[model samples]
Target: MSGGGPSRRVRADAERSTARILEAAEDVLAADPNAPLERIADAAGVARATVHRRFSSRTALLDALAAQLNERYVRALAETRVTTAPPLVALQRLTETVFNLKLSHRFAVQLDAAVTPEVLAGLDLLFARLRDAGVITALDPVWCRRVYLALLHEAHDLPADSPVLTALSAGSEVEARINLLVDTVIGALGGTDTTNGLLVRSVRTSASDDRT
Candidate 1:
């Protein structure tokens, strides 16, 4: 029984260490995909041996990061309640979630293994629903999806101190930028009617959460 306590603590520490390494890998690789494991270990504030113990090689580490991003993507969708929420609310939540996801894990999104086709199809279906609801004026849902993704990619690339980010006085600079990105996407999709009110309410809830 005494041994179990120490074993559990060891496991917990290992888990924490692994998580740190993965986060550091995301940050480092996002900047330089060819960065060495030593660089990641330095970023994680862990020894090279520790990173090697968890990930046998750089490729393995990358694979793990991609998997972690996929998990986060799935979790983000669930948190948005995409299937049950009103179409406009769901679109705003989805856009924000995806924008933040790409912003946080840039390298993973670039990888081919990150998001599976099935997940993307569901997102496309969401766009189609918006079209059916008269929220998106685009005749082609595929075109709307492409435009939305393009805008997200552009928004994620904006520097933290950019004027676009600076103009919004909201919960945080990033939050403000994301909200603006959502609005831009909505506008580009021609959701310029009552959907604007729905989007505002959705963003207000998100901003409130950030304040708390």
Candidate 2:
């Protein structure tokens, strides 16, 4: 069916206001999930009434954020080139990307409340695609999804003073740890061997340096 159209100016203003409102809402909620609508409206430089008009209620705003996060997830996954890498490597990269993104965005704290079952169920479809594409192991997609979520959740919670965080902030440590974790999980699933070659290499290298 053909849709009725608003004028270009009206649409543009709406688009701008919506973007501003979402950005402000994200900031406010990230700081405190229970922040009131008036505060969000203030942050957005809009009136409280306008905020309500734009988003009928707190639930509506949260729902919008959840939708925005899923959109980001889809975009990140699409941009990731997993076809050429081994399944484990691809999974590691994907998890690292997700973790890094979450660390930069405080909205991650609201994930538990904002992400509805329907949204998560939709994510299963993406997991299925990855599995079918052989970009991930043939384990239960649900389990894989949970693992991916756990990695992001843990990364978000990692203390700022942690050596892991320091290493990750410096370079590829986050990726390295994620790879190690994936390998461990995959090995436990009997999909591969747990040789711990990387750890062994690190230890051997450290001993050699000490002797030097």
Candidate 3:
């Protein structure tokens, strides 16, 4: 007798299709946050009914997206050596890794996902490690973490054709982005800036900036 191989194969295929839909949703929503579900299904090369079968509703779709992201976030934090790595190194690694996670999910392109308490608790634990390691002091560790994440989203959320985004797309882009972010972090922490560090210009904006 067969070990129900066909049923197992069909289940695996369904799982992969669901994953494909989620990934496409992320890319599509990143570009057009209000993109329709039909667009996402088109991007994934799946039928609209398949999207419905998998996600049921926008809320369900978003839930799946957030769940996938939570897994990635937990895995990322586990890999980052906040307590052992050098301050700047840890900062760079964590910022890049976390920002990449934001990019990797449909539900959090703006880093506005419905963060669960477990995730926030995990962040607090990481910040405590940084404080104990003397990587950061004076500044509240929670605030420091927020600043890093804000810097990441602000810089990366720019339009694809934005000059800042274009320049950052050149060689060693992640390194360049990390340098600017780390410099901002160091400055905010009242630490001395490194010699030969990137000198990012201060940005100024007001209500009018949003009207542009």
lDDT of 3: 0.65
- Point out the higher-scoring one by TM-score: 2 or 3: 3
TM-score of each candidate structure, all chains considered together: 0.75, 0.67, 0.75
- Please give, for residues 16-40, the per-residue lDDT of candidate 3 as tens digits: 9998998899888888878989999
In angstroms, give how far residue 36 of model 1 lies from its true place.
0.6
Model 2 C-alpha RMSD vs. true structure (Å) is 8.2
Alpha-carbon lDDT of model 2: 0.62
The model with the greatest lDDT is: 1
What lDDT does each candidate get? 0.77, 0.62, 0.65
Go through the candidates in order and give the C-alpha RMSD of each one to the true structure.
4.2, 8.2, 9.2
For residue 131, give model 1's deviation from the true position in Å. 1.8
Candidate 1's C-alpha lDDT? 0.77
TM-score, prediction 1 = 0.75
